[model samples]
Target: MFASGASRRCFLLIVFLLCAIMSRSGVQGGANLCSVDFEVFGNVQGVCFRMYTEDQAKKLGVSGWVKNTRQGTVVGQVQGPTDKVREMKVWLSKVGSPSSRIDRAVFSNERDIPKLEMRGFGTRY
Candidate 1:
């Protein structure tokens, strides 16, 4: 039977909280997938940066592709579990190949994805 208004509101509130928790914990379908595009500045090119990026992505269990841009920068897109994607971002922004110098990193098109766009990490050139 339908309860009083207060009781009904409480039940709805509990359901809402449960849904929020599930989504946050990635219990819901595809809630934990994230996608981001990044460009690394500084001496990123000709330093095996793309190779290192692919390696890092694979290590982190993410799927993406990295390539050298004509502007003397490294560009890529990464998609995977939210936490792993975050780690990859940090690696691109701060740490790169042994000989690479990272002056700045720019990220764009960041969004939550329903699924990964790629199967495995790879170099695009």
Candidate 2:
């Protein structure tokens, strides 16, 4: 009976150790994921541009947040598969907010983006 109890305790300890290892590994794996940031310029403000960008991004399965900057530029940081990000850029450039005109767009790789819970999109003061 004592031997059985010892064996059970040892098994539980091993399981606990494995769980810890997996959790740690998962965090490291997530850190390795890549993301990108985009700075969109031109009539990107005051015409529901941010909202439109968010919608397009969501439709493309791109994960990120979009907000208006003080300079009237729409800034967005999208993180996901490279292809999806590119698709979002194309969609935004071609068929974004009808009232807004896009002047320039810059893309760059970023470290990681914090998860955001946005309804549609929003303007930042």
Candidate 3:
């Protein structure tokens, strides 16, 4: 009886752990729960800012894309470890476009784009 009880407890624990892992990855849970969105404003256009951002994101292993808006802003989506996303924001502000000025940056947990493929953070049409 003692051995059977121990085995049951172990099985329950394993099941709980699996659920937790799956939830964190947004696989079992709803999508956009683990991703981050960023809106970068400034002299982000016309200075190769998009290319620079793409390079940085790829180096940091961030999965997302950067693009320019008609209103002259740079918008990007980065999905990865939360820490890495935060670090990318810092890098963008400090090492972004030399000719461009990063006037504002906004971070949100809401997932707007769905399953967007990002290849090295380049510009999108």
Candidate 4:
């Protein structure tokens, strides 16, 4: 129908305007990308902490790298959607490897990244 063409055009225009508004409002389609660096202290080394962290990060669809520090702690950086990053931080702080005793997790250098700096989660060294 001729009316159908006009209505379709109007709908597309509306959709375009909505997308513009959303982008201008700081929406990145899915969510804002966030990155954070964390160091977990207390009984983290030699406990498969980095392995567990890698698994959890992959499961949460995040990308980052984890490693053991010379000071017997676990250090890592996580980058993903804001909510996913928050969840990862909680897991690092509270629900670390079953064999690991997490005294506390210190997060630093947290910022909103326009894009992810890493691809895929893994253990470093």
Highest lDDT model number: 4
**Local accuracy of candidate 1 as per-residue lDDT tens digits, 1-125:** 55699998988999999999998887888478989999999999888888888888889989989999899998889998889889998999989999999999999999998777779989987
The clash tally of candidate 4 reads 0
lDDT of 3 at 82: 54
Pairs with backbone N, CA or C atoms under 3 Å apart (clashes), candidate 1 = none
lDDT tens digits, residues 3-33, model 3? 6988989989999999888877766634442
Higher-ranked by lDDT: 2 or 4: 4
Task: Tell me the deviation in Å of residue 60 in model 1.
Answer: 0.1
Best by TM-score: 4
Tell me the RMSD of model 4 versus the true structure: 4.2
Candidate lDDT scores, in order, read 0.90, 0.69, 0.74, 0.91
Clashes of each: 0, 0, 0, 0
* Candidates sorted by lDDT, best first: 4, 1, 3, 2
TM-score of 3: 0.63
Ranking by TM-score: 4, 1, 3, 2
lDDT of 2 by residue, 40-61 (tens): 8888788988777777776776
**Alpha carbon deviation, residue 26, candidate 4 (Å):** 12
Kindly provide the TM-score of model 4 when superposed on the true structure, using C-alpha atoms.
0.80
Q: List TM-scores for all candidates, in order.
A: 0.77, 0.59, 0.63, 0.80
Candidate 2: the clashing residue pairs are none
